[model samples]
Target: MKKIIFSLLVLAASFSANAQVDRSTMPKAGPAPEINLSKPQSFELKNGLKVIVVENHKLPRVAYTLTLDNPPIQEGDKTGAATLSGALLGKGSTSISKDAYNEEVDFMGARINFGSQYAAASGLTQYSDRILELLADAAINPNFTEEEFNKEKALLIDNLKTNEKSVSAAASTASRALLYGKDHPKGEFETPAGLENVTLADAKAFYNKAFIPNNAYLVVVGDVDFKNIKKIVTSNFKDWKKGSALPAAFTTPKNVVSTEIDFIDMPNAVQSEVIVENLVSLKMSDPDYFPVLMANQILGGGGEGRLFLNLREDKGYTYGAYSSIGNDKYGMTSFSASASVRNMVTDSSVVAFLEEIDRIRETPVSEKDLKNAKAKYVGSFVRSLEQPATVARFALNIETENLPEDFYQNYLSKINAVTIADVQRVAKKYFLSDNSRIVIAGKGSEVLSNLENVSFKGKTIPVKFYDKEGNAVEKPKYEVALPEGVTKQTVLNNYLEAIGGKDKVAALESLLMVGEGSVQGTPLKLTMKKTNKEQFVQMIEVMGNVMSKQVLNGDTAVITAQGQTVTPTPEQLKDLKAESAIVAELNMLDDETIKLEKIEKVDGKNAYVLALNEKKKAFYDTESGLKIKEETTQEMQGQTFVQTVLFGDYKEVKGVQFPTKLSQSMGPQNIEFTFSEVKVNEGVTEADFK
Candidate 1:
């Protein structure tokens, strides 16, 4: 007890001595901390499969990664050959059935995945040998059965269809097509026709041709010993015969002569996607690498980036704006800044994006910005050290990309050394604002007119039209002059007549509908009811519970969600008044404020557009006169966004035409509701609205 008391007194005295020295002055950061990066021991098998082993005994776990480090191969007519080869590689080995292999891997609680260019497996350290053997068998002795091939092909086609209507997918396809050209393998996407052209034989041929060990790398990290892993790797992968050298013939993609606009029109688009991109040849080994990354970080790499601050925080144009700069060793890489913004501000958003890009190039970044960028990179690098996989990746990168042995160890110092001038220099060399493709995939009919006259630095940037497939086309005329005989009343009357008739629609005193739908893949049930008294109620249920409910009783509107009830805003009240009607178009016919705006194409079909009181726009197909789509501005959870509701699969419900499918896309997710049954003038009462 006396000794403990003396030790406590000494400790307190030591703290008092240090605390009395200085409390106000900023302490200097000590010298740079030494980095003890694990150096991987490596070897090679007879067939040239390079093996890199990194040992970390902290946990009883192991990870194995086998990468075929080869350049892009041209598949020509077989665009998805390599993709199929990778998909079918992990089905089974010659010695084991597919089910048995999967069962054993699962029984061992390990994960094994085979890709066209790589294979990976990770689990407990005790199962490392077996996992490695499984990987080898899957890679070297893969059995390409016809049934599995057909299944994979079918899945690919199904995914293609799912992505067909996705705006983000369209943007990706267009960007790749523009940057790499559709003919290049880097840009080429597998289509239904192209996938159909691929066969089991073709997939096998691609596997035999590209899955060679001459340019392969195997990385094993975690609780592993170099000697033991070396033995396991040698026995399994020794038979992976090499000699499949990559074809050297390739073409590098080049940027445009000058800054220009490339537009792809999606008539249903509510938000415009802007991508400011250019070709850049950047590698990790280059001296400019760190500077380029820092420059991007300052410009648009994160929430604090200039792009996000200007567009989202300052202008309220988008939810987020981000930039990415890729360093591809085998193919042309790109530097891009992108955002999806409101339709009304599409031109301003584009201008803001370009100005930000140009401003970063012209002016040097502030000291604060530079400091923040450095701090972020430093923090990220430190956090990455906590992961064994990161260590393995770094080691593999050192060998494959030909970096200095101490590159990762010196990463922080290099990032800290980048100056404002270095940032500006690399920005000028890589960003290429003056020679970039301002790719805008949007509803061009609404934005093009506003954008074509938009001037940057007092010079107007002209717009060029392109189809969704990246094929250049002429500009589409938005406003089609109607003949003198076709007046607003004529169009409205045509629509009313097309739907069952004026009297029949007028007889729709009430409606009650129950339907099933999906929201980002979660199943939801919806209930909607309306009465002739301009009152409506909507409820959304998930898993047999009401998730949200919107109600309009005469002039008052309220919405209840997540156990909270709130009155609708004035703008929401206005919008609800229109929706309260059994049919919005029916109410529009009586209102003089609404007018026939113009004739535009909806999915390539001529449609009559009606300006619905400046809050919404309605498109009715010209020949059929059926209301096909309606776009409206909505505010939810304090965010203002555009909601586009597509009406299709029309069927006569009693005396009126009713749409069976309703699709709504808000922000990024698309939700669809297909009604199995809808009844008009049935099961709707005033009590429901109350």
Candidate 2:
């Protein structure tokens, strides 16, 4: 009881002391804290390898890093030379077999990877000496032969094939090409031809010319003695050839004269990839570096960024969106904000994206925003300091970037001193609203019209179209007139003849197709059945779990998905009925609205376009008469999405031709369905339709 009474008395005294102070006045922050950063021990070998060692005994692990400060070079036809050189590295040495080398590394539980301009190894300090020796042996005496080159070349070719259809991949390559001209190193891409042009001799020559130690820096950090590391590094790198790599000269990147929209048409893209970027001359040594970084953090750093809050939280147009500002020493730097959004909102998203940038440039951020950005930087810097590798990296950066030795020492104070005015100043300087390129790769038919009229602050946005190779192309013609001697029946009859004889296609009564494939990386099995009487059923299973089912048994049509059932709209019902027939193209013959629209190029092939209905356009290969593409619009959840269906791999099944491979795109997702089982006439029945 006495202790409780004493506590109450102390609480009353504290309240009295607090009440005596002013409540409205803000409390002043304490003086900046002192920083005691560790400095790395540095030494240079006669071979020109500069080694930096930082010792910390807190952990039993050590990391050794070798950075080649080679300037970015345009590879021309040999774009994969550096990449091949890196792949050839660590394959094996004269004294060590590849198998034995891998086994020994695994035995010691060490991780090492070699890149074009960098290599690193991290493992327990107990094996530090062996790891260093192994790294040195592989770095100097690499074994490159035809066997590994062939294997690596095949893998690279496969990657290029896969990238051909990926929307994000196309956007990345195209963005670089659009921002920096194709002649620049940043714009070069590795193609199959380029990779094939690389020989083993070429790889070796690249390694010899670029891996010289003159501009190389090795950082050693962790539970190792500085003196021992210096000796080990000298012993390992002493025999390395004493040569200097000549720096590469690159064509400087230039910004646009005015803000413009650059578009690349990707037929299979479900979502549009948008990148609003500008070229700048930023470096770590510039006074605007910290402020620009802080301003970018406020604009689109992460989940808490303004881009996310506005584009995702407010409009729900995308999953995530972000922006970044980067700096480089040898070449021009860039600032960009990128996001992939549903096609319907591509224009709106672009507008909102520009609006955020404009807001930052024209409007100064609030006091709270400035404080939060500073806190974020300060926190990230402090957390990074906990890692020994960060210390080694800081040392290397100071040398390579020509920064003051004490730049990192006052990191916190510099961040805290940044006022709201600094953030606005850098934002305006770097985020060039009037001279930026809005580079986008998407379905041109769906988003192009909307972009042509997009305006920001009452100024109409200018649009430019470019091919995947960054070549300027004429605007795609939207409304082409039907040519003479081409009628609706001419295209239809040609398609029938290309697939099968007209008599054979007309003889088809019932069809059943069992296709197995993937949608967005998920396994999907599609079972579709149709009869001559318009009795149709379609079901989809994702990994054997039925995801959706649609049925039309000559009467009511209903669909089930996500544990809910609903009757499709009248338009959907009409579409289903048109497709319910065993041969969907036959319905076009009977419908009065169907007409020959025009002839256009679909995937570089001359295709005759037919308006099947108010919302569907079918493209048929003019030469082969096979249906090549289907363009349709869908209304889902109060939003309209344009979908494109591609057909290929036609095969004969019981005297009828059917597409064995199918792909469909719907708002940023690709769905590929390949038929494993197909039947005609006898396999489908009323029971199957139910």
Candidate 3:
């Protein structure tokens, strides 16, 4: 009996193995089962509320969405008022406190969400039939209370602070600002200041003006009877009042005539963020919309896009980069790229980004590239419908954009019909290198000078500072006031002597200086090398590793661990030159005026704080008694670090004595460092740089 069972099992396994065959060689299978799509029914209530219902009995759940099209037509600074009002609505309602509403929703397994766009505001709720009445109550009778409004406002402000620290968020905001002028309704970006100005009065006024039933559309989808849904909506919204029709809020802006470069300086940045944008087709109905979308895909839309292939795979300047167009009532298109290259190669990287854009416009995409792009797009699109939310969103887009009912059904056909000529034409038309607005956010002094030397167009480019709202704000100009009894010449010459004697410092073969410090309680170490070239290695043992290198004779700047290297942008190059100048000035300081103050135990190690004072302060007499303090400390990584250096300590290294000892307390551990040998005037040679 056992032998017979074993033989039967082996036979079963063999049969199963043979059943799997090569799908490509097999006969074509029949089409999949047809989807039972819900047909949407529409009606208008007595109070002018437009209702749309799509009945789906596949599951015991329902989803409701309400939208209001009352964007601010007469704009002052009321940009995000509608959005804020929608957000505050869910905090509480007339009959229920916020806590009560939250608890009820949680117990019933339901969700409610609300938001606003430039021309519309929307709310969404999902729950079973048993809790449908509660959802209706929250929607129809929102409290819009003063306390709730203030609390929501504070939350919005806090969220803005968190977003400002993200590079991607900042880039997106900056790109939109350039696409639409700061004042334009379509382009208005949120800022901490704008959010702060929003009050209970603003929320109330906005709600009253925009949230009327007449100006809104309610969409419901789920396992509910059409008649019952209609009856429920009518009874709940009967008391709602009609409102005046709102005028369209967004207007298309004229395309910029020339390319402009904007810079946002993030001091002590290890990488430079770059974005290039310009106007493109705004209307989904525009003849160029499809072509432009397909063109961007071929250029820099994803992993296989032109930018990723050249910058990441070929030259290795960035970990990744991409570009796309924002298709809305107003069109704004842009190509953005980023790299954390050495401070020296910032210019080279910018050149490469520009070159890729130019190539896409000048050269028509190859047949293979076009085919691959279409295949990827179509495959991705088909896969997206696998999720119900995506399918619903696709259907909603057709309704919102006023697109043809057959749009999704014909999507693949449209993508397949795009020709090589279409790609080339759109690229040439939209990729305007001269008119592109270039924005660079990085350490300004380390990247700007070199950028200026490179001629883009016929003239030198000017760098402009932008506020969080994307407004061009003038930077505050101020002169540094020196302490009393300091002369300009004494400060300049004596500071140089402190680093090392002028000749000895100039003849030094190479210098390696390690710096450690704390930023917001996070310990950080910066390894700096000065030879024929310059480089900085930033290590935060707790956080990880980051490195940047710039070679004097080469145009390339490299960020090793990230696998990125490229020429610096024109702006980046300019900053690098300025940084070199400051370093050069410090190398010329005198010794006697600059001396180590004393050695003291800091964080369990012998550490020294060097002090430097200028011998003559006449030429540099913007201030007197100019002093620099340098603190040194040691770490367990077998590294001696200069922790906190005060440039204001005027006597140690003449005018700049960097702290040689320091420790930063983080959590339960303290990151400490101590510098071992302090040598000035060692002949730092060119070979050391490489």
lDDT leaderboard ranking:
1, 2, 3
Candidate 1 lDDT score at position 361: 91
Candidate 1: 10-residue stretch with minimal lDDT: 26-35
Clashes of each: 1, 3, 106
- Indicate the TM-score of model 2: 0.83
lDDT of 3 by residue, 1-690 (tens): 999999999999998887876666857534432334455777889888777777666766677767664544444576557667778766657888889987877776677665642111112234444355555566667777777777777888887874563444665677677667666665676677877676778767776766777767777766768888888877777887777777666565666676666766543233567777677655565667777778888888899988888766776656666887766652443444444443455566666667777787888889888889988887887777654455455555666676887666667777777888998888888777767777776545557677556455456555667754566766422223334554434555554555554554455434455555545577555554544344322223334455445544334343333446676676556445433432445543444555533333221223232443321111121223223323233233332222332232222333234446544321123344554333333534455445
> Each candidate's lDDT (Cα)?
0.87, 0.85, 0.59
Tens digit of lDDT per residue, candidate 2, span 335-390?
99999888889999999999999999889899888888877878888899898878
Query: Which candidate, 1 or 2, has the higher TM-score?
Result: 1
Q: How do the candidates rank by TM-score, highest first? A: 1, 2, 3
Candidate of highest lDDT: 1
True lDDT of residue 396, candidate 1: 90
- Model 1: lDDT equals 0.87
Please identify which of the two predictions, 1 or 2, would achieve the higher lDDT against the true structure: 1
Misplaced by over 4 Å in model 1 are: 1-29, 93-100, 487-489, 502-514, 530-535, 543-545, 551-558, 567-588, 635-640, 652-656, 677-690
**TM-score of every candidate:** 0.90, 0.83, 0.63
What overall lDDT, based on C-alpha atoms, would model 3 receive against the true structure?
0.59
